[model samples]
Target chain A: MSSMVHHFPILLVAIPILAAAITMMLRSKPKLQTGFSVLASFSLVPISFILLMNVWNSGIQVYEVGEWGKYGIMLVADLLSAGMVMLSSFVSFLSLIYSLDYIEKRSLSTYHPLFNLLIAGLHGSFLTGDIFNLFVFFEVLLLSSCGLVVALEKDGVTKSTDKLEATFKYLVLNMLGSILMLIAVASLYATTGTLNMADISVKLSAMQAAGNLPWHVFAIGLLFIVVFGNKAAIFPLHYWLPDVHPTAPSPISAMLSGVLIKVGVYGMLRVFFFIFTDLHDMFQPIIIVLALLTIGIGAVSAVAQTDVKRLLAYSSVSQIGYVFLGIGFGSLGAIAASLVYLVNHAIAKSLLFLTSGGIIHHAGTRDMNKMGGMVNSSPFMATAFLIGSMSIAGLPPMGGFISKFTLFDAGIMGQYYKEITIALLFAIFSLFYMFRAWLLMFWGEKRDVKRYGEYSEHSISPMIYMPIMILALMVLILGVYAEPLLSIAQATAVQILNPQAYIDTVLTRVVR
Target chain B: MNNTLLSLTISILFGIGTFLILRRDIVKVIIGLSILSHAVNLLIVSVGAFSGKDVPIITHDEVASTNTIFIDSLINGIFAPMLNGTNPTQYVDPLVQALVLTAIVISLATTAMIIILAYRIHEEYGTTDIHKLKRLWG
Candidate 1:
């Protein structure tokens, strides 16, 4: 109803780019740059919440860039996209705040700018309606994330070369994934005649209804699995994540694990559910089967990990599997469950990673065996870590428990009994690995000075732990007061199932 | 016939790129990435080539080629002129060129960054071998 609301989609991306540029310019004054970037990042929270509220109130909002209509790039913020943007902006803001104290002081000049660019990329990828623009934002995400991984000053546990190794692996694999994405996008364009997603959706449906859909169109749908699968770090394409995620500085690690890989999940949802709706029957089984393996492999590898960060990274792989499992079910209740699962995982996982940063900083080691009973060293971090673990492990009184229950419940409702059975088994795996890591790090005898060497002793800063506390509190509130989130996710799932509303809103009737 | 030729060439480049990526040398892999990206760029251009009118690059004849799939639109061309519903005779699909240009720029930045990363990696690890660079893989 309002013209200003029409501009929110583009503003969501543009504000971050403006913030990055301004943050880069203010680099000479460290305090000003930090304050400005933090303020800018925090400002996105209300804007995205407003965007989400608007979409909920008045259907989908589409912003046509350059007024090119259906022919040029567009930004469509549907319930799914709006909710994802809201989640990323909230997580990025908290991560940026956590970064202020955690990142090395000398590197602050480069850190804030790169971090803002990363946020911009995440928002843009979630918000863009043009398929090619999705590719461009993905590149933005890749480069900025690699830069942060390879260039930042890491804690002692991750060596200089370790970051390099991780970045190289991440870059090469993503490069391969990007090429596949181009092939898919181009071929789809060749067949469909449009890059605009809504326009393409209309054309694609028309083609299928005409009973003349091309074979290559089906191939492109599957090819998207590799592209978004690589981004999400699911099975078969998940090789780079464990190595890459843990080697970055802690705040960056939180972003990677928390929201970045979920980009792939977003891509899958957007491309498959929105544009390729006719092919749902073909893709449903494939996605469910692969998602099951992802859960198994991630849980197994997570159990075997001793490095605290690496364990969390592997656990993320498993958690993402659960989210995908819900997605693969393809029911309204199931998709809603996935959205609920995704939000909980993003919050809980980011909290855990940030807490791990403090733990690593406190214990001066990443190896869990080397970190002994540190509960007394920092009671605040101990409590923070416990809350994050409780939430991620899907224990009662945490957000993850609600999501896990909803997902499994939805799967059962959809008559996916075997899949639910396997998933329930892995849910136990998550509980095991999470509590095991926490106990090994927090409850054992103190770090042995003679056996493992002396740890650097310093007071954990409030700047570091405060963000973790906020996120932890969010997890608690989500678990206790779950109605608002459940209703929102339900609305998002309904929007996802009904693609016509999205197409009609994005491709205005004026075109015909 | 020309579509077959371009598709053949793109597939060959893809094969070469895939092979190079399997090599042990890191620089070779970066080269592999560049070639693979170029192959994708060519694939995009070829997609347009499939839909394009017979411009000077493909032919100089007065009438456009009839073999391409897009010619079906010409059945109602006088009424709609729907090559993307735009004028086909004036130009081939320019959107592909725009898309290719964007892809090229992105791949350029990515390739350059990767090369610098390979160099920094060589400096840090004293090896250009990707296999030897698995320290983070525990």
Candidate 2:
């Protein structure tokens, strides 16, 4: 039993993928399929936790799919991946449970399989050893998510048609990204002659020091930035997110905003710190400019949204900017803050979506104009929503405030003046949008009364309430007790900055 | 030398593809995407430049070794060896091949998805002009 602990990283990915297959095979029985999905989703938590503990005790863990010379694929559990695994797995698990009730009214044929596949793909993306394999995992996630969007569209023909169009647009743009990424990977392989990430890093670092022609490396690296930027929803490349996110089912929106976009961030870090650290100085300004723009645009757009879900969607784009800002600072402190903020945002944003699900469920509309005085009516739900909002807005005693504060402090300490200015501006903009949400939904004279007016004053269903409550509590806990999370993030950041540490671990069997 | 030719052709295709992608027509965009994708594929394959080889496998039983066992019989080969090692230093970079194969599959998938998206846009809006679909733009 103890010996099996080493396989946890692979298991995190394998379980969902195998479950997806098993679920598809059991399509004749929806109950069995849903049960298997829930079981599979639940199992990821323990596996991720065990791996997290192992990584905490030891250093990073690596699972080469086969022996390196033979298979050339590896899955590693470093600090960054382990932390993301825990967040993604927990959110996926909770979302599945939430979906059990939420998806009952919706179609089931494609939902369960696609949902599980998306989880599998996300897990694979986080764990993958080689760049090309990461792209494969991304494509799997993208295709399955497209199916998910169409599956959850409302019954009206026009609305469904609109959703279908938006979903197609998302698919096309993502496909464009995939093509560009493949080109970059191929170019890298051509130059380096190896697909192993650690090997490429070492080779590229040597080439940089030798002062040889570095154009191939730089060109490929730039292409990757553009490709991952599209997926990450950076300011200029974020055209698809607001439309696709709101059109999907609420739970799917949570996963896309919470997990999918983060995959892009994960890819960026893997490349930036591991494969391209030597070039960081050259690229720092470019990254800072993009991050600042994404932050400003996301906040401003979020403020103008009347649709509750769209507002949350825009807020996600804004919050994603902070993650980028943290990355732009590129110090130990900045990286740690970014990691902590990533986890916090995942929880807070998912909580917001779940609460929106409650509102959408009760009100049957997404317009905030149609929702008023719900705070007095369903105080439990309203309060939970406020908690998520405040956490995202960086208010005191909540997780977002501490995480963003550390990020800004790190930026200033690093003397990246432009990024600091952007952070301050985003801070003010975030407060505006967040409070605007509160004022419109909770404090107004009861105006739109159709959805919530009919319901008796009672507790929200436990199925829905439990996840949001847990997330809300986590937001507070993450704010107050930042040490444990910070340590995990710090360890991950250290491993990323020092690529040799990761290379030595994964290439344990490789001879110099 | 041959690689340079392939590289030039690919760059030309890529340039044209980018132009098409910027146009408003959906079909042109797809064609542009395909062109860019093929150009990229060409560029990647060319990165592994293979020089004096007749398709690597030598015999049914033995794979091509890095160092050639046979010597030129006329002058230097009866007592001396032409190749230094059993395995040649230059093999078709297997890593690039794998990356290319995966790239092809991903690109194919993306192409299919884009085509479907184009069809859907045309069906609903009755026009493929991107400007007409700009409902949310400021």
Candidate 3:
């Protein structure tokens, strides 16, 4: 069992890639492919949980890929990486199950393989200690998502033109981000002569201690803001998100909004807290200003949207702002608050997007104005949406409130009074837009049949509804029993702030 | 002086890439991306170049003797110092070469995907102009 622990990190990434290849071979038979994908995705949840528990019991687990020691590529799983892997696995498993029924048969042939590859990419990025390897996985994520975004659907309601345009914009901006990342990585290596993240952190801190750190190193640190800021879709870089996310199929939308953007947040945390710890004071004010603008823009734009999924996409942007705000506070308690916010938003936002799929199926339109009195038809969906909205709005007895409360508490503790006030004002913007979108869809009179056509008589599938209900239940459970998650997040925060354990583990481990 | 020249060329490439990406034509944007990736790959290679003229491959005789010498030196209270008096022109840094290889492969995959996507976008929208492709906005 102890020996098995060494292989767990690789297995978390390898299983998905192997399953993706097998899924491609079985593509002609959609049923077999779906079963295999579900099994693969479902199995990841336990594996990730076990990995997290292993990391918890023993400190950072470093798996060097070719036994070249720190000179070769490594996969390091500390509390933060392990915790995020668990969260991503849970969300992905549910989303895969939902995709089984929600995604069209024509698309499923390619969807299963692409979805698994996306999971592989996400896991690889989280676990990799090599900065260059992270870039590789990011491209895997970008290409797979691009293919999935334009995949053909049964209803064909989402136009190919819109998908193409969205993909183009997403591709252009992310490519630019990748270029910036490569330049930064290259320059850092030139200065420090290392690629392993832990090694770089150690060398950088040494340089700082000696008071010989070059000014270009500081510039490299700021360049990372563009690399990850584009990924997280903050403020000015967020324009592509509201367009790209809603244009993808709903299940993919759930994945994108729920977990994908968090990759950016994870990158920010890793690079800023670990690699650039010397410049924390310098970067904090800049991050605070950008986060506030992100919240304001996302909230303000969400209010003007009439499309259901588009509104949710914009809301994701605003919620992400709060996470960045917590990070910008640059304290142990504040980072833990950000982690908690990340987990809650992942559950609640995915739930909302999944439910929106069912709603769109019933109404035959994406416009909220075309949807009213939906509760009279599907009370289950109404309840699910209401829970998701309430949670996102920071109402009591929901996970969002706990996350928001802690973030505010951490901000106040950190004495970021002005920034917290602006964030608080935007929180109201979130409430108004979320509830307004919810009421516009579920309350008042149903749209006239003469104009928008009759609501479809086809009932919502159990496969689709089950995931939404489970996620909604998770939201409630998280709110009521927030202790365990909070403790895990706090542990993750401690691990992130102190890079000594990570560096020691990665550098000192004997090559086998 | 070589380092200065390399940095200047990289900056010029970046400027051209950025200028091209802002154009209306989608194909031009793809070209710009390719150019940017090439520049980045060059930058990676430049970062790895030390004052060396030989490949990084170490012969077996050198490896064995160095291993024994390193152990002996450690035991004799003398640290193993390869870079102090050794000829700097013998070998280049191998790690960044490995990094560049991986970067090139990744960029190749991404560039191919983007080109295919650009072609598809042209097919779907019947135009390659980015400004005309705006059906989705707030």
Candidate 4:
């Protein structure tokens, strides 16, 4: 059993994809398809945990596909990748469970398959060691998400036309990102003569040491900002997110807000910290500026949102900026803080989005103005939203507080006063927007059932509540008991700061 | 001169693609995206297309005292004697071919998807104009 552990990384990706195929085959059997999806989704949590523990105890695990060594695709399950997979799997599992009840019957036909493939993509993106494979997984993510977004929901708020428009915008924009990514990657290959990220790093550094590194190599590195920034929804490339997020069903909204954008930050960290560490000094100022703009724009725009989902989507935009700021600082503490911030926000924001699903369920509309006195009818949802909002607002006893505090503390300790000050101000704006949306829906006059119709009894299903409650519990737990996560984050930050460990592990794979 | 011309051609395609995408027409946008992807594809080919290098073509040459063995990367790829141990170097062309092939496949899938989406969007919104497809206002 322990010997089978090496296969966990490939299994993590393969299981979901296989399950997606199985789910598609069982399309006529809805119950069976859903059963398989739930089983697959639930199974990943344990697999990811064991993978994480394996990496923790045994160090980084490298799986070279088909035993072609570095010549073939490799999935490097380092602490960072393992930990990220665990986070994504956990949230996606919960979100998958939530979708069981939230998705309309008509859409459920393709939901499980797409959702499974999406998880497969996420796992693959987190695990793959090759840059080209990263691009493949990203396209997988894009298509799966586009397929999911195009479907209608039970909420009745999303029109088919809206889905079409959002999807068109998403596909077009991401198509541009894809082209840019290929250009960057192809150029990198041209300059360094390799697609394996570790090999590229070694070659680039060797060239640098030999005093003849091409400047276009750095230009290629900078182009990745556009590529990943598009994926992560950072400023200037974030337009597709707000439009796309609100039009999708609620659980998918959670997945998009919670985990998908983080992939961008992950890509940035991978490229800059691990591959382009030399690019860090030059990239920092530019990223910090872009991140600040993202924060300011996202926060400012979030404040003006009438749709609860749109507000959360914009908040995703803003929150990703903070994560980028952590990346931009390029210090061990800051990166660690960013990891901490990322985990907290992913949990809390997913919780809020799930709670919004419940809210949208109860209120019968996504418009916050249409909602009032939700607390009286759905006390459970009220409590959940309160917890999610408080956490996001950086209030104590919720995970967001710890992450936000650590982020600012790291920034201040790094003497990034100017950057942190601006970040802090946006943080306050986030606080206001988060709670204002909360209070407007949960605290005002009694809901007008006569106009908006009755609350959806569908909101109260175990499938929905189970994920929400678990995520809420996780948010609280992350706040109250952060030592384990913090230690892991610290270790990950160290691994990231020192890329030699990763490169050595990858390059030294014995050919079979 | 060829490299310069190739570079100019790629830049021109990029510019044209960028311009077309900015048009209000959704079909134009899709075409723009296609052009951009093709431009990048050509750029990749250009990156590998340095003049006077041994353009590696499939030949079942001697490799490791074997003549008929296939290279692992491709199903029918011949083991190039010049590519492995005896050769002190690696050519960028083969890698570039693989990358461009993957990119082409991906772009094909996405372009098909975007076209389907554009058709659906037109069906629903009654226009291919992106300006008219603004049902999702923030």
Against the true structure, whose DockQ is highest? 3
Model 3 chain B: worst 10 consecutive residues (lDDT sum): B69-78
Best by TM-score: 3
List each candidate's DockQ score.
0.47, 0.27, 0.50, 0.46
Q: For residues A1-512, what per-residue lDDT tens digits would candidate 1 score against the true structure?
A: 47877788998899889988998999899989998898889889998999999988988888878876666678889989999999999999998888888888887788988999999999999999999999999999999999888655435667878888888889989989999999999988888777888767877777787787888888999999989999998899887899988999998999999999899999998888988987877898889999999999999999999999999999999999999998899999999999999999999999999999998887778889888778877778889889989998998899999999999999999999999999999989999999999899889786666765655678767788789989999999999999999999999998888998988787663431
Candidate 3 lDDT over A1-512, as tens digits, reads 88987898899899899999999999888889888999999989999999999999988898889986776789999999999899999999999888888778888899999999999999999999988889889988888888888876555667888988888789889988998999999988888777888878877777788787889987997899888999999987999999998888888899999999999999999899988877777888888889999999999999999999999999999999999999999899999999999999999999999988888887888999888988888898899999999999999799999999999999999888999999999999999999998898999888766776667788777888889989999999999999999999989998888888888899786642
- Candidate rank order under DockQ: 3, 1, 4, 2
- In candidate 4, what are the lDDT values of residues A1-512, reduced to their tens digit? 87799899999999999999999999999999889999999999999999999999989999989987776799999999999999999999999898888898878979999999999999999999999999999999999999998777777877888888888888877888888888888888777656889878877777677677888977887899999999999999899999999888888988988899889989999999888866678899999999999999999999999899899899989998999999999899999999999999999889988988888877778888878887878999999999998888889988888888888999999999999999999999999999999888989785565787656665388988999999999999999999998999999999999999999999887653
Kindly list the per-residue Cα lDDT of model 4 for residues B37-120, writing each as its tens digit.
999989988876444345555455444355522232222222222343333234325767787898899999999998898888
Give me the displacement of residue A448 in model 1, in angstroms.
3.0
DockQ of 3: 0.50
Candidate 4 regions exceeding 4 Å error are: A447-450, A453-459, B1-5, B49-92
Give the Cα RMSD of candidate 3.
Answer: 2.7
lDDT of 2 by residue, A43-130 (tens): 9998998888888888878776765431368888887788888899999888877777776444775688888999999999998887
Cα lDDT tens digits, model 1, B12-110, are 999999999999999899988899999999999987644545552434242243332123231342311243334555456677888889999999999
Off by over 4 Å in 2: A104-106, A153-158, A448-460, A510-512, B52-90, B135-138
What TM-score does candidate 3 reach? 0.96
Q: Classify candidate 1 by CAPRI docking class.
A: acceptable
Per-residue lDDT of candidate 3, residues B1-138 (tens digit) = 989999899889988988888888988988888889888988998887677787776667776655521111222222212332355445677877777788788888888888888888778778888888879882
**Candidate ordering by TM-score (highest first):** 3, 4, 1, 2
